[model samples]
Target: MSTEVAQNTLSSLLEAVQPPNGGRNIHDPATGELVARAPEHGTEELDAAVAAARAAQAAWAARSHGERSEFLNRAADAIEASAEALAELLSREQGKPLNGPNARFEVGACASWLRATAALDLQPEVLVDDATSHAELHYRPLGVIGAIGPWNWPMMISVWQLAPSLRMGNTVVMKPSEYTPLSVLALAAVINTELPDGVLTVVSGGREVGERLAAHPGIDKVMFTGSTATGKAIIRSSADTVKRLTLELGGNDAGIVLEDADPRAIAEDLFWGAFINTGQTCAALKRLYVPESIYDEVCDALVEVARLMPMGNGLDENNVLGPLQNKAQFDIVARLVDEARAAGARVLIGGNPVDDQPGYFYPTTLVADIANDNSLVVEEQFGPALPIIRYSTLDDAIAMANGLDVGLGASVWSSDPAQARQVAARIQAGSVWINKHGAIDPRVPFGGTKQSGYGLEFGVDGLKALGAPQVIS
Candidate 1:
């Protein structure tokens, strides 16, 4: 379909799906335009979506893995075909740059993940071949999965849940965050055209709808990606139904720069690693721990490169960075940066928002010589502001990095790969990187180790997370 046709179709569909109570308005973070409306679906809508999923689950599960995978592949193909239009919508709604490794990149990731997961194979395990009785562990689909996606990297993350769940033969009723619901809606609208009516659905809303979906007994599994606090609430609600859950929650990821590493050599990589998607990424490097010997140099290297990276509206292809996606997030980032500055943290670069900007556009901020206990260093400032702290010893650096309750991801930068791996092994996180941070593969499992979240996504573990393993003798 043409871009104009797709836009009109999406608008009509949005109008059709809008809740009876005139749902919440979704605004473009760059221009503050009323981009779309997220239907404030509540208990009734949640139940209806889950019921549809349940009705479709049987036929979907009855299909062979190959058949299910084919559907996923078709969806991926559809996504790639309409990528430009989708990426444009994503940039307008998500506030990420459309080109130059931003929204377009993310939309590409969604297609890649869907196609990859579709092509992936998982065989039933034979456990006791030599014994008197033979045993086989078969992965069977759960009835219906309730997937709640966060706003940051909305399209890719939703596919991270939907692709695997559908590949495992489970139908899904998804709830994309109200902040950026249009992307998911547009994506699902395209993909669902190829699949059965109830196989996949998107219900847009805030907390109430999500609560109902998690608590409802119709859903066999709840796969949520969002805040730690919200994850806890889902846990409490899902407890009553004893629903299986896979939560990918918050992260205050830290990256350590060793004295042996070249700050200038890795400066650009480090900058993108932390500030990709304007640092709204859950796995982005929020805190940088630099050795006292090279702390100043590392700070200077980051600021020098960060200043050159353009920040503007996502539609402008020249802009590598875009505005914060929402006002709440912008305020949070502002408050944290201001508090850190008040606490004697040195602002090495852009510390303030673009004065009187149309939207929530904060500058690429770098806090130097900040104490580990400072809020900017301690909390997850999910924006472009990064805090670089000085550490005297490796032990202290590791301690400071591991001190936080959130441990989604961490990285070590050093000249020696082996040495970096040794230190990486000491850090408590789900994924650790050497030289780079947040470069994930579709075949590798990605998850968190502590309060960040539980259950894995991607690879064999991800496939199994959507199903029940039944051992047959």
Candidate 2:
């Protein structure tokens, strides 16, 4: 899309969601400027959306998978056409810069993921093909899906939940994070243009509405991405109804650097892995375990890289990092970093937030010489602060990395591919990268192992997660 067209589309989407009269006010985290007001929907609104989705599911499911795939492809096309507008709005609301793997990249990922999901084939498997008896395992849509998304990577994660659900012929009623409703609303509006009415709806409501939706009899399944605390609540709410769930929850991910790894060579990737989205990512590397031999070298290299990366208003094209999406998150990050500082952790780069800054802009901080038991090292800071812990042996490093309760993702960095893979295998996480961290793809399956939450998402398994399996004989 052209610049003028994109701007026009963004303006229209903003105006449509923000009626002059009502709704909750939303501000840009990067600048504290009024971006727009999202519709403050309540339980009544959620119930209506769920009803609409329930009414639409059978007809949607009745269509052949090929027919559904065609609609998804069209949705992808619409998203691509509105990609720039979506990215601009996402940057403003979610506090991610348009540059780098932040806003624009997220919007692009939404489209690509949709297309990739559409292309995936989930054919029924033949259990037995003998002349006397033949059986086949098939999947069917599970009515309406209640999809709850997070503030960080709002658009992309919503796509991660909804695309496959829709492909499997399940209608979806999405409740976006209170922190970022406009982005998801706009995204759903664009997608709804291609889909049949009531097939997909967005209920931009609060906590009560989400709770009701999880327990609502109409909703057959719930897909959530957020904190482990909330994930537990959803699990309990959905228990009585026995609603199927696919949760991608909280993660205190770790990254391990072997003695043989070159500090300078891997520093840039390590920096991005931890600091992406200003380090608000669930699967982002929160703790770093480095051998005592190269610990100082790694810290220096990370400090060198972190200082160069610009942190400013998301609207500024030059700035790659932005503020925490909300004050609560800002407080959490600030408190943890402060606690780490008080405990004598060496602040190699940034540990201070500019008091005069208008927005929730916590500076990019790298805390080194920190013990494994330090609050910053043990807890999921979910901010731009990274705690680098020193260890003596590879076994100790691995143990420290796996000590956390939550394990969504982890990484092992080494020169040798075999060594990296072997080390990666030992880390307790849903997904582990050999030399990279949080490099997720649509084609691959992803989920957490322990407290990180369960039920797989993405790829064929993700599609199946949205469906009801049956064996035909």
Reference-based lDDT, residue 329, model 1: 95
284-388 in candidate 2: lDDT tens per residue? Answer: 989999998998999999999998999998889999999999999999999999999899998988888899978899999999889899999888999999999
TM-score of model 2 relative to the true fold? 0.98
Clash count, candidate 1 = 0
Alpha carbon lDDT of each predicted model: 0.89, 0.91
Best by TM-score: 2
Pull out the clashing pairs in model 2: none
What is the alpha-carbon lDDT for the whole of candidate 1? 0.89
Candidate 2 lDDT score at position 362: 93
In model 1, residue pairs whose N, Cα or C atoms come closer than 3 Å (at least 3 residues apart or on different chains), thus clashing, are: none
